[model samples]
Target: MDTYSTATLYINGKWVEADRGASFEVTDPSSGQVIGVAADAGTAETERAIAAASDAFPNWRAQNAYTRAAALLRMHELMLERSEDLALLMSLEQGKPLRAARNEIRYAADFLIWFAEEAKRIYGSTIPSSRTNQRLTVLRQPIGVVAGITPWNYPVSMITRKVAPAIAAGCSIVVKPAEQTPLCARAVFDIFDEADLPPGVVNLITTSRPSEVGDAFLRSRAIRKLTFTGSTAVGKMLASRASESMKRVSLELGGHAPFIVFDDADVEHAAKGAALAKYLNTGQACISPNRIYVQRGSIGRFVNVLTDRARRLRPGSGVDESSTIGPLIDMTAVTKMEQQVADAVGKGAQVAIGGERLREDGLDGGNFFAPTVLTGVSPAMSIYNEETFGPIAPVIAFDTEDEVVAMANDTEYGLASYVYTKDLARAVRVSEALRFGIVGINDINPTAAAAPFGGLGESGVGREGGAQGIDEYLDVKLVAHVLGDAVD
Candidate 1:
């Protein structure tokens, strides 16, 4: 794969240098090597990007739904054509297994495909008027310019999830991707440029000074909507800032998801689901299973199977096809994982599989933590309360349905929850009782491009997919018609 070294910023449909002529190195997490150089921006550059989006908003939003859908469909096709290159680029910069990278590319493209169709389906309803000669109809209009902030993890997917809907709804946007993985953002913009997207329709700015950029986004009246995906703390900060201007805000923040296994669940199937949910992306995902609760009768067997499955996973560089577990994003992630494991062990939790980091082979210089399974983890332990964000599974035992439901819903984060059971009534009951925005009944992957994804409570506000996803970038306007005369 060719390195995107010397990648420049895309603003107003043209590639330009940063005002300060600054650049940053994008590192490959798996090999601890510099992969590419990306343009760096500050507050001034961010403001310029915002200005560009604002300038293009009027004409871009004036296009009909079919025209917007056609452009989105072209981008979607281009994305699929470059799938292989994009996947390798993702693996090089983001450090996930190659298969995972490919899957993410496909998933990202699916957003474009899904939203291309949804663009033409933004329908409004008519309200009945009291007078026969009067008419009332609702209108959905683009909310002008949107400012988006995407995280490093799942770079391609995160950007696509935001940009696809924004474009589909005929809104121009300025995107600020995480500084650690700006190359992926540049690559996506390259595809957008190839699709001949209008100048200023989409702008990219990479900067380390996120605070200054965020302030610029908030200060600009042209930016009517702000969308962010990151930690709950940052999400709260952005929400607070946007509140002053009364701007629309959509946040997909942190999560501490729960996985519950009933006594009647097939132990093998449950184990497989747990490994898939908790170990993908080294469990760095926001919706990763943070806690697993099994019925007392099945706890022993569940732990045994999970430990064996986790032990069999090969931890190595994401470039390797055979390696299922890849390195964490950085040393800070490794250090945090170690502290959580140590805290759990000190609280009487037993390490059932791995409890150490892998410094073997060529991995000594990289950030790799062994797949771990802990038993006897209790609410008293820190691991039980905090998200591990690594390939560590902490198992807790529960006696009945009510007890497990209470245990699962005890967290302030309510993003996603999983329930494994053979009983239809229990599945429905548990699904309804769970406070999460997304619930999986005997399924690990509840997320789909066609489904609405978001969370409740401190997990942040608003929906990000399905029909509601585009709504975040749009506003409702009521149009009334008076047949006879204008009323004062």
Candidate 2:
């Protein structure tokens, strides 16, 4: 994984550096060390990428679905063939554990495989006509060139989630990956290149100047669609900009998901699920549980088990096979965790486990924080209202089912929520009551390639997976025909 030499911009089927030779240093969050240099593309490169996508769109859309599906399937195969390398690269840049990184690679590649089959199934329908000589038909067509802005967290999967569906729907795309993990994006584009995708059908530009690229995408009439995954604020800004040009837009934004544990739930099992949900990817995920609610009767047992699990987690460099928890993406994430914990404690919350940074055990150089659990967390605390995108879980107790449901749905975000209960009737009732796009009833990980994944409200619009994913890149056309006397 020699990222120093490997990181470059992929445009129009060529690997190149910035036009002005400008570049930025990429650091490994685990060690706070410069791992590589990535091309810092400006507005000029962005426009060029947009032009390339526009130029490639017509021929790409004209190709039959089978041709497109073949290329995507090839990408899937190449990704799997090089999964280990991909996983290592991601672990280095993104700061997730090696095992987690390996799992992410598989999940990311699954998007291409899933959409490859989905490409062949973009069906249109025929409508019955009122007159004997009249006919009506409907068609689903590609929306043309797309501009994609992916986030740092889950860099590989975020790119595939957008690019796979766009390509599967016959649209060409230009992607601007997060500055922190551009090497992973470059690696993905390498697979695309080896798959023999047509030049300009897929392009990548690594840049620190995200605003410049975003503005370029907004101003370009050539880019007909915009898809972004990041903060709610940024998503809103991008959506507003896209709306000014009437460009089609889809956003997967921030979330403050709630994890609920009922008395009916197996406390030990629920505790295990909570630990995974709260700490996956070091809680940087948009769908990670921000708030944990336990029934008053189960709170004592649940907290004890959860705290034991947190205490047992080993935090270090992601490359360490023995490490279960990894460093935060940067110092900012570490600072946020500190601030949140401090705020909660000042508001009378008690730290049941860890509550400070990890400065020992060779973790001083990186952005590392202890896995923390806060009890007596109240609505008055900042952690209760804000999305704590770190390894800190705030537990709040509730008296009844309705009370828990109300507490879970008290946020503006509506992304992912979790409810643990063995009562079948109770699971259905609470699941339906929670105002989120995806709910895991007695299950922690609910996302899959074959299921629609997205958020509601400020959590953002549109979906990214399953059969409906391709639809985000397509447009519908209805044709009505009137026939004269038969020529035969």
Candidate 3:
């Protein structure tokens, strides 16, 4: 089987090669060797993409909801048909297990399906008015072209999460998928093209240089909204630049999520869920539980079970059937994680379970890290305030529920938090008190396209998914008139 080296950027309903037509070397994370190079974007190429998307906006916004929904439905179908290919591409660049990648592909498709149905639900309200024969109505209108800058993690789903809602709201989009994992985004964009989307309604650019594409979009007066999912530092930089044009910004940034296990919790179930949450995608998830703050009594018991489960995980190349945890993206993440681990260990944290990088010789050159568990993490440690973004879960014990809640809310991030209490009354109280965007009680898979997803404070500004998603890409308009007379 041939591996793809370069992927073309799609713009104005056409696949385009860069003017310089440069290339980049994409390495296989498992092997830390160059696997292939996709199309590399220079300044000129990025400008062309922006221009293509800018030119398409007027006509795209003119499209009715039905027309837009049909295209989305078509794109959704094609996504299903080529799931295998896209999944392989995702695994190649993203370093997730092929099955996990395939699952992500399916999850990505669900957004299109959901928003396709949601398009019909775009409705407005008529305002109640005094004065005889006077009428007033408020209509939600599309907000021109949206620039979607997605990170490498969950590339396909992130793209779908933004694009589906934008398109369903009758707005066109330009997606700047991460240069590392551009193939999946390109594949989805291909489905949109094959679905017969009007030219400029959807475009894509793959670039190793985020600055090149970012500068192009920032300088352009045509792009109306900038939606980004990445680090808080970068997101802030982009937000500052986008502010020059006063562009509407939607940001989903970093998270240092916490999992609170109360004394009354189901220890076994909570531990399993925490294992899945922390180890999913090797803990690359923004919402993955990084800090496990257990009630003091339950702490010892929790780690015993958690350690037992963590030891049994399969770690190897993403394609391996026996593998449960997969590699970090590459040496960069490994190095960063290693440094953070060292820092935490230096700050007096104890290595309770798995730690250290896996030897490639044993696993046929795969980049695998053993699932690591640490305990006694102090609040001052880097691992507490910063998101490690790796296959590491640290356990910290708290004395009381209030103390646990205070500790969880102490961080600047509020993307996600988990509570394992079974008491419904206690659950409601703690859930509301967590100060995070989403909360789960005795659950792990709390992510749903139906619910609004985002956080407060530094985590992000606007919400994504659910009915509120369209609101981020829309401008509300109110009209008032007197039916019986010019002046009522």
Model 1, 343-437: lDDT tens per residue? 99998999999888889888888889999999999999888998778889999999999999999999999999999999999999999999999
Model 2: lDDT of residue 430: 89
Sliding window of 10 residues with minimal summed lDDT for model 2: 1-10
Question: Model 2, 451: alpha-carbon shift in Å?
Answer: 0.5
The parts of candidate 3 lying over 4 Å away from their true place are 1-3, 360-366
Clashing pairs in 2: none
lDDT of each: 0.90, 0.92, 0.85
List, residue by residue over 1-488, the lDDT tens digit for candidate 3. Answer: 13355546787888877667787767767776666667887778767777877787788778777888898888888899999988877776788888889889988888898899888888999998986688899998888888999988897999999999998887788888887777667667778879988788888888888887899888889889999999999999999999999999999999988999988999978888899899999999999998999888888889988888899888877766666778887677877778778988999999888778888556556567778999998887888888889998989989987888899999889899999987889899999998999898888878877778998878998988888887898888999877854675
Highest lDDT model number: 2
Which pairs of residues collide in candidate 1?
Answer: none
lDDT of 2 at 20: 72
- Runs in model 1 deviating more than 4 A are 1-3, 486-488
* Residue 120 accuracy (lDDT) in model 2: 98
Error at 129, model 2, angstroms: 2.8
The whole-model C-alpha lDDT of candidate 2 against the native structure comes to 0.92
